[model samples]
Target chain A: MKNVKKVLAIALASVMAFATVACGNEGTPAVGTESGKTAAAGTWRIGGIGPTTGGAAVYGQAVQNGAQIAVDEINAAGGINGVMIEYTFEDDENIAEKGVNAYNSLKDWGMQMLLGTVTTTPCIAVSAEAAADNMFLLTPSGSSTDILEGKTNAFQVCFTDPNQGQGSAQYIGENNMASKVAVIYDSSNAYSQGIYEKFAQEAKNYSFEIVSAEAFTADSNTDFSVQLQKAKDAGAELLFLPIYCEQSALILTQANAMGYKPTIFSCDGMDGILTLDNFDVALAEGVILLTPFVADATDDATVSFVTKYQAAYGEIPNQFAADAYDGVYIIKAAIEAANATPDMSVSDLCDALKEAMVNITVDGLTGTGMTWEATGEVSKDPKAMVIKDGVYVGY
Target chain B: MKLRNKFKFDKRARQSLITYAMVIIAFVVVQILLATGSMTSLMKGLLVPLCVYAILAVSLNLTVGILGELSLGHAGFMCIGAFTGAFFSKCVQDVITIGWLRISIAIILGSAMAGLFGFLIGMPVLRLKGDYLAIVTLGFGEIIKTVVNVVYIGRDENGFHFSIKSNMDLNMTENGKTIVKGAQGITGTPKDATFTIGIILLLVTLFIVLNLINSRDGRAIMAIRDNRIAAESVGINITKYKLMAFSISAALAGSAGVLYAHNLNTLTASTNNFGYNMSINILVFVVLGGIGNIRGSIIGAVILTLLPELLRSFNLDNLRMLIYAIILIVVMLFNSAPSFIQFREKVTAVVKSKLPKKGGVN
Candidate 1:
């Protein structure tokens, strides 16, 4: 009898607490804007979503910082079409449900457009909801095909995962970087698997043979001596790492220890390896990677963005930061091209932006005259850069 | 008929009714708030998931609290249920156009499949006791997640094809669709899960778990939990009772997974989805709610799940987790400290004496 009362007592108390929290807010309508032209805030609300704190925080934090820099510049230049652009970012923690919740939170804050969700899996989930709501979404660094597969309303600033994979294969084949290549990838991650699968398939078109394909799980990400040794034993001239730099750093150090110095090649995930804490820079001396942005590029646009980003964030911006910087400018172009107004409905603006995205090409930090396809893929050429004296340089 | 006639408004009956009424009243209040658009959007989005964690916590309690065994792999069972349930929904969604009917069938199938795995695993695993069982369950749990990542299935005009190698080996026709795409997971699963359905499932889980805990078998199970060898010496079938508790607990966890899968569009098998961390989280709910307390688990799951998301609203991204950690320690002290419980009991007793008695239901 005592136990029964205890159960009922706790249950009742908890329910009351929940009820109070649920009724804490008196919300307006859940949707962004009504069908008819509604009186709107003079500022364009652009909401960003990404993992601000987690294993993938590097990417999300870069995107957020980069977008903030661009937004500040745009608003300083008298905003987009003379209306100030209001920017807000929500942290998704790289979880799909949390990402959707962040999207809803942004909607509650009266977001007119979305600029992110830097990771892939969460982007896929959020993109689906954005597609249903007919919201205009432009992800900065979400490179998976699934994120934009059927969602025409969604666009990417970075090249798709397949583009990097196919481009790497073609680049290597064109320059004859290596005849025998050994690939190491993280199979647990969708982005790595997506790139690896395409690269392997595309490699058949080139003269190089993928000698050995080694895989690792998220749990087994650390300790790549076995993988490095296998690649060395295969007499591979080049080693392809379709993984993030966190693991790639350990792999390079281990390979250095074992005296197996093959030509190291990677995708964009290795762009900011030099900035990693406690990592020896000499290990990455001759590493080559296919990326859209090189922080040390002498080009005026790249140098300006890089300089401003470093002044603000106190670090060299990676490819993710560059993509997000390009994302904001591209949104500016889309709005100007469509002549979209703050008073227009969300669906109306989405339709206008969808058409404008493909027609208007914007030259920005990541690419020049970058145009988007109706398929939601960005058409951008990737530059092959090599690590020289600890800084990335043109190959 | 005689038993039905003999059913009276006893103390136990009244207690159970209070629990039911509490759930009902809360549901009604939320529905009103939702209709009026008064609930915060973050809370609104978290509605189904709150129910999911609550259900998962309660189900896990059946094993850790009632069965007196530590199972760190309960999330593995959840992963199995989620993937299978989502897969079934994707396969038959077109044929079974009705939402409620298909969801009903999916829940049953998902629960049954989880129970089947639990029973089969329990056969070999039940022989071991204590930490050995925990280690083995944890091992198998990871194995399940790892296996699902590699498994790929597709559907075409000809039929269904399965592959462990890769999605390419499925060799589906041009018109065929790849249902499972390795690590990318099943996309475009119909969003059939609703808050109403989640609440109904929670109620169903509470009924089964609470009634099971009160039955004759429940006594035997508890007796075994208290003194396994003594209960066995007194003619209790230890293996039978233990396996029964475990498999049923797993089935309920599976039902919770059904809700989890349908709630999200992209269903991928990540470590955070169903891994060591998730199992530890459910265990924390069971332990914090007070071992073997069903109502406490529900409340604990709700509060803990909402605490982090609620804190996010304040824009304290850096300090959000730090605050959550402090609150967790404080709650642990309140729930477990010997002096605190004594103080709380005295305070509650005084409060209870001043409350008026309600009319008994006849």
Candidate 2:
């Protein structure tokens, strides 16, 4: 018994010692080695942020592939300034919180410049955090005009939808046909509401009277017959439906069944021209919308991008995916221009990128010269697309 | 004979003060590391869930190992605690000036709030005493989540506070704003949590549980586990003691929720649903760790958390889940009998081979 007690005491003491030592080791600082630039040497490490999973997974994957294609092309062309450019991707899951987490994680891994987020919330969150961390961020798809309102460290390569709204308004005014337009949109969606707000504000400029503007819930919204009937009774000749492709298709389908046929003007996403078994092309024909890219819309750079993407993906890429592809290349351009080496500090690379992106114009895949304004807003001319015979064609 | 009696080993020894002292020391060391921000993000992410699962598994040990009752919906109590804690934390953040004090107060208040919910929910549910109890708790969890979704979301507009049906006309206000963001989740939470704080909270729970298990009440509770009718015949307040265990589990879960909410800086109603999967997962850790053993639960938590991360570098995101399954199966297979002996012997031999036989007189 005495021996057993003694053994127990010794065992307990040893356990306590082990626990203390383990806990002690946990508190010590990670040994700082050479910075990423010095350790890897003479390589540009650009970072990409997108929702690799969740609601915007398709969008995120497109951006990732676009970045990969650009990097492969750049590397094949004897690299940038005799140094190879590498890319790191972070799955932000289309969430602002995850975006912040991913941004911090990438910074810790020693990335230099970042491609902005695919979704609006994450784009705003990541850009704000990048500014705080003093990193350069550029986005290709998140075109909420509010994003370009005040941000300095971040730049948008896509023209704001308000620019497209202005163009849409000009088109409507030039036709000189419709006076009253009814607008239906999803308020909760930043993209939808952002374009809606700009379109409504710009309609006043063209003296196009907005008879009624109503916001509906995104997922739970089912019967728009009541809303459509009200618009028809109001003699609305032009119905501007700024919504997602699936929901817009449903709304237009529902409106056609209700016998309320009106000229539809939508924002960029409406150009997707999605068709359901219930969706008839006659209901969607002559639908006008603005887009940054069309799959067959050929330019030297765009054709090359689409050809390479098709070679790899074996399918035509959508506008969102095409935009994401451009987003990746834009980051690569900034990184290559900065001549970022792994040894340099993230802030140092960002400083170089700031000079690189400012008033920086490039003849991108869009076939238009993309330049940044003083506020880092891109000056890309958005092309308006019209759905002709159930297909979107650039006009 | 007298000397032998004096030196006799106590088989059912009570927890010694020295154990508590050692736990405190360990807690202090962990805190030092966390406060200094030296811990990696993986470590930081694992820390809260570890401490949370530990509290849950051990407190749950009381139900399964002590009271011999299987109760699910533990995550529901945690959800209650999280929201309650978040509400208080947000209030205190706006009303108070100091950050650290707000965190300390929020945790205490959150735990108490969870305890209250546990008491209310556990009372009638504990009476059912078996599968019925589990079902009721599960229902309670679903009800909480559903309520969060259906409830009108309130926001603080510039000055005019009201729920806006559409984007075109949203009035702004400050007073009477919707406190809870509902299904969209409550964002903008303060990130005041650290690894040290989590470790300290876990150690406190361990101390409390160990102290409880070493008491007379604990032995009686264990008696109920072995034979409920026998314990009841001996005037053991079966219902009362079971309620105590349930409330304690709820309080600990609530504290874990508070820690989780503050650490992650976000809260969603879905996080709380006392789904069967979560209940089983927590139970898996407890059972895997050797039920009723605090050390075992800690080990289980660490292993479970690290296993997924270790699989990440393989770049085979598809194969990661398969590997995890294989690891779990292997661990479960070796869970019973003589495995520890073999493991220790292998470790000892490896260490001995690595080092030169102590005294080459060098």
Candidate 3:
């Protein structure tokens, strides 16, 4: 027992030592040191929250990459109003409780504004405290309206779920793509359910026949054979998939194996489907979806942003990255429009930034003429694109 | 001799009292910190979650630790309670504007509903043992999440309607409101969960669990755990005791769920809430805390829940999980290894020898 106690004590002491060393590393790079240029005035401290280490880590990495790129570019171009942007990124692990903790930690660090909380759930979780504290939170890819509803200080860069869903339906109807449609969505996901519901509602207006609609939760096994078979039996010419990329890839794989070929219509959730490994690009051929940003757009701004993003990250920026990249620009524009000064208190700046966000129109990589609605939702036109030869092309 | 006997402590009762005292002390310390503004907002935000996790770990310990059964569907009960509590609170939001009172009633109703589910699932599941039981319970958790996702409840001019297909099938009036939006989940739930209430509920859980541990039934359950056939020969109805312990465990977990649901404005049936990962997380707390030790469970839950957040402040974002894993393994080793126990005893003996002994007080 004595030996055991000594060992236990040693272990405890070592763990504490490791913790101290880890904490010591955090202080090495203090806030406001992102750029080599010294701030003549006070720096604008911004906090970015996302899941950098969990199931949604990829999206979080993309968001961080985009936001960091924007910050670097701004700082290189003589900083925002001659004050460098000091950004801190916190990993929330895609959990609400952790997200709240990250929010508090950043707030304690004297952050004037928040740039992210990449996913929908964390965005919703963090927005509550953000509203109470009067902190401005601009989420790049949290498309759920639930995050923005009744929250004055929270703003989203991505088009809301309803917009994507309704836009998809309009595109299908106007283009005369399909007379009969079937829907398969993850009922457990807020983003999926939100888009699916709006699509169902809008389908009535389009005079399309709803053949079959099947629901599955996130906990369901990967085999979507039953749902796919049902849609096939219903003779669906178009299948609406309002789920994320991974799930869409699996569903498409299952449908392909079953020889169920249907023109797939999806929302922004399926944006990164083509990037999945072992995903037969042929299965996704002719798949159409509405996205706020497309990499292949011929516009100069789009080409420039895409080229820069590829050079920086060695990959094409998906809609999530594009939205996050735009989020930083929007924040800069809002701060400039509000005439925010270094003398203003954090709370005062946050209030001014919130008011400014409501009035300013941002023309960023995602879309031009982007404006915020009274509901804190962003209004922007999305492009209709179809996957061809493993690349997204405007339909 | 009588005076000496009076001073003699009943070991079990003393242990129980110690557990309660530890909880009180921790709560007081946190309260003081909050009052002094020394605790970061991140730590303050964790206070309620810490309570909820402690409650879950302790109740889960009742089954996995004392009962010696591997029940993996504890999160299913939590899911039931969360949705039930959120739904009840949503319905009575305007009627009972008092946050505390509404949450109080919601807690009772939610636990009762969870208890009912526990009883219903336990009736047949308790017959199985070991790994088979674990698989079934896991399946049950998955089923609960899926069912909640597909089940849509809405209120209209006519009345409340339930539908499995879609919310559109609910066929409600124009003034209708969806209380449960299938996968969209229960949103706009009353945020009434304060650290004070969470700690209070945790105390209540401790009181019930510790008392149960000392009761005759607890001994009988433990007896079954030790030797089921021998216990059956001794005329202990194995099934009855198992179900009782399991149902109680579920009810307590349900209470934790209610606390969790009220803490958040939006509650969804996602992996973070009512999925397999959450169940496993609670199990980890129980195991890492020294199975069957209630106080250990609380400590484990509090430490593990805060570890990630604490690590985040260190900017070790990528290595946080690796560090957490290392600490968890070391703690577990110290908790159960024979060599570690021997080392601990030696240190304690030396420390006791260095200290002066009490004399006349006894």
Best by TM-score: 1
Worst 10 residues of 3 chain B by lDDT: B353-362
Q: How many backbone clashes does candidate 2 have?
A: 9
Q: Which should have the higher DockQ, number 2 or number 3? A: 3
Tens-digit lDDT track for model 3 on A36-68? 123225678788999888788889988888888
lDDT of each: 0.86, 0.66, 0.84
Instruction: Looking at model 3 chain A, report the run of 10 residues with the lowest lDDT sum.
Output: A31-40
lDDT of 1 by residue, A127-179 (tens): 99899889999999988888898788999999888888999899888889899
Model 3 over residues B193-300: C-alpha lDDT tens digits? 999999899999999999888889998999999999999999999999999999999999999999999988778888777889899999999988778989879877
The predicted structure with the larger lDDT, 1 or 2, is 1
Docking quality level of the chain pair in candidate 2: incorrect
TM-score of chain A of 1: 0.93
Q: How close is candidate 1 to the true structure, as a TM-score?
A: 0.93
Ordered from best to worst DockQ, the candidate numbers read 1, 3, 2
Each candidate's TM vs. the true structure? 0.93, 0.72, 0.91
